[model samples]
Target: MIKHIVMWNVKGDTPEDKADGALRLKTAFEGLMGKIPGLLRMEVGVDISRVDYACDVVLYSEFDSHESLAAYAQHAEHLRVREELGHLRIARHQVDYPVTSLPVCAAAEAA
Candidate 1:
C-alpha cells in the first residue's frame, strides 16, 4: 500500500475565518471518499494544537499502489477539489511513501 500525507496552512485573517477554512478543507477532501479508484482509505484532520507553527489541516490517505496515487493526482474529482480550495491554502506540505510490514518485535507485541 502507498501512503499519501499532506499538511496545509490555511489562509484567514481571523480565528473564525481560519476555522471555517479548515472545516471547508476537511469536508471537501472527505467528500472524495469512494469517488475515486484505488483510494483504499481517506482521512482529513483539522489541527487543534493551537501551536503557532502548526498546519491548519492534514490529510492522511492510503492507495493500493504508486500508480493509484499518481492517478489520484490527476483525477477529475481531485482537480476540481483543488481548484475549489486552491485559494484557501497559504502553504502545503506532502509526503508519499510505501507501507512496509511491521518489525518483528512490533508485530509480536500486537498479539
Candidate 2:
C-alpha cells in the first residue's frame, strides 16, 4: 500500500481568515474520500500550534499502489477540489511512501 501525506499553508493576513480557510480546505479534502478509487483511507487535520512556521492544514491518505495514487491525482473530482483550494492556499507539500507491515509479536514478547 502507498501512503500519501500533504500539508498546506493557508493564505490570509488575519488569524481568523487563516483558521476559516483551513477548515474549508479540511472539509474539501475529506469530501473526496469515497469518490476516488484506490483511496483506502483519508484524513484531514487542522494545526493547533501557535508557532509561526506551522502549516494550516494536513491531508493523510492511503492507496493500494503507486498507480492508484497517480489515478487519484488526475481524477476529475480531485482536480475540482484542487482548483477550488488553489486560491485559498499559499503553499503545499506532499510525500508518498510505501507501507510495509511488520509482523505482530506475542503480547508477552511485545511487553
Candidate 3:
C-alpha cells in the first residue's frame, strides 16, 4: 500500500483570507472523494496547535499503488481542486511512501 501525505501553510494576506482558505481547501478534499476512483481513503483537517512546523492543514490519503495515486493527481476532478487551492495556499509540502513494517507500539505516534 502507498500513503500520500501533504502539509500546507496558508498565508493569510489578510486574517479573513486565511480562515476562508482553510475552509475551501477542506471542502475540495471532501468533494474529490466522490470524484476520484483510485482514492482508497482521504482525511484532512486544520493543525489546531502551536508547534513551530504547524501547517494550516494536513492531508492524508491512501492508494493501491503509486501509479494509482499518480493517476488521481492527474484526473480532471483533482485538477479542479488544485485550481481552487491556487487562490488559497501560500505554500504546500507533500510526501509519499510505502508503509514500513513496525511493531505495534500503541503509544508512539506523530502528527
Error of 3 at 47 (Å): 1.4
Which residue pairs of candidate 3 clash?
A: none
lDDT of 2: 0.92
The Cα error of candidate 3 at residue 77, in Å, is 0.5
Ranking by TM-score: 1, 2, 3
lDDT of 2 by residue, 1-111 (tens): 999999999988899999999999999999998999999999999999958898889899999999999999999999999998899989999999997764366555776
Off by over 4 Å in 3: 100-103, 106-111
Evaluated at residue 3, the lDDT of candidate 3 is: 92
Q: Scored by Cα lDDT, where does model 1 land?
A: 0.97
- In model 2, what is the error at residue 49, expressed in angstroms? 0.9
**Clash totals, every prediction:** 0, 0, 0
For model 1, residues 1-111, the per-residue Cα lDDT tens digits are: 999999999999999999999999999999999998999999999999999999999999999999999999999999999999999999999999998897699999999
Name the better of 1 and 2 by lDDT: 1
Cα-based lDDT for every prediction: 0.97, 0.92, 0.81
**Model 1 reaches what TM-score against the true structure?**
0.94
TM-score winner between candidates 1 and 2: 1
